[model samples]
Target: MSFKINFDSENVSTGEFQLVAEGKYEASIINAEAKEWQGQFSIGFDVEIRSDVEQKHQGAKVLYNTLYLSSTNPEYAENTEKKRNSFLVACGYSGKQSLDLDEVVKNIIGKSVLVYIKHVEDKNDKERKYPRVSFVAESKVNPPQPSGPPITVGSDDLPF
Candidate 1:
């Protein structure tokens, strides 16, 4: 059985920015890959998103529409050995909207992004099979920030 995986972006974050003109903004696919399975099994992935609006830009507003995904490519490999055991997918986005950073911050900030997965099968190829899949989003704390030089009494010794 053959399978394909894709995401809107490899990385996504919430921030503030000024818009000069009104135009349609779209999220692009950062990366994609496929894996084939020979034995009976299942595969899954976890997706998450983080925002710096609250800490960086307070009271900033923003707007966003529904996220979308599409299957643009479907090419079967000729070599059977090229098949994969399973697939692991992840994505992210970075941009701005009309609203301030604070407005959209609460919606996406410190929140776990969930992705829904569906299986597609070739009607003509009944012999081939695909594994069932599901998605789960878990909220996580922001990553630790890098500390700069530290100021202390006495001589100016570099601190890490």
Candidate 2:
């Protein structure tokens, strides 16, 4: 007996090209890690879209976000800091306590979050597009509603 491999038909992907549309998705930080390039430091996240969403792209693994922690250029450094801060705030970090960067990266893994995905054209190949996780926040099952008594409106409050 002998076995043969079919190069053309045996190991090819048959799934169609799909993109997660621009919208918010319930997701989780499946993985996280510290990254560096050209002496610049950063945190990278791998997010997975939850299967409960209505879209067909659910359960897809997507690159969530990247936070650059170190940079040589002043302006770029400042922008990176702001972006990281915003991410921390969204994650419910008060910004008052001291944070260990490595610990923070590890803690974020497996955390449920709401991810905003957007598409942008590839710089080198303008015709091609990719989904980019633009923002992330703590997952809230339901948005908050206003409390207290409802006010009664009179005709006097009406304006033409």
Candidate maximizing TM-score: 2
Give the TM-score (vs. native) of candidate 1.
0.18
- Residue pairs clashing in model 2 are none
lDDT of 2 by residue, 65-92 (tens): 6767767887677877777777777556
TM-score of predicted structure 2: 0.67
lDDT of 1 by residue, 1-160 (tens): 9998776685655664443122111112122222224532221122222233133222222222122121223453322112211111122223332433233323333333322333335479976433222332221333435479875676556473
Worst 10 residues of 1 by lDDT: 80-89
What's the TM-score of every candidate structure? 0.18, 0.67
Off by over 4 Å in 2: 1-15, 53-56, 70-79, 142-160
Q: Candidate 2 at residue 75, lDDT? A: 67
* Whole-model Cα lDDT of every candidate shown, in order: 0.28, 0.77
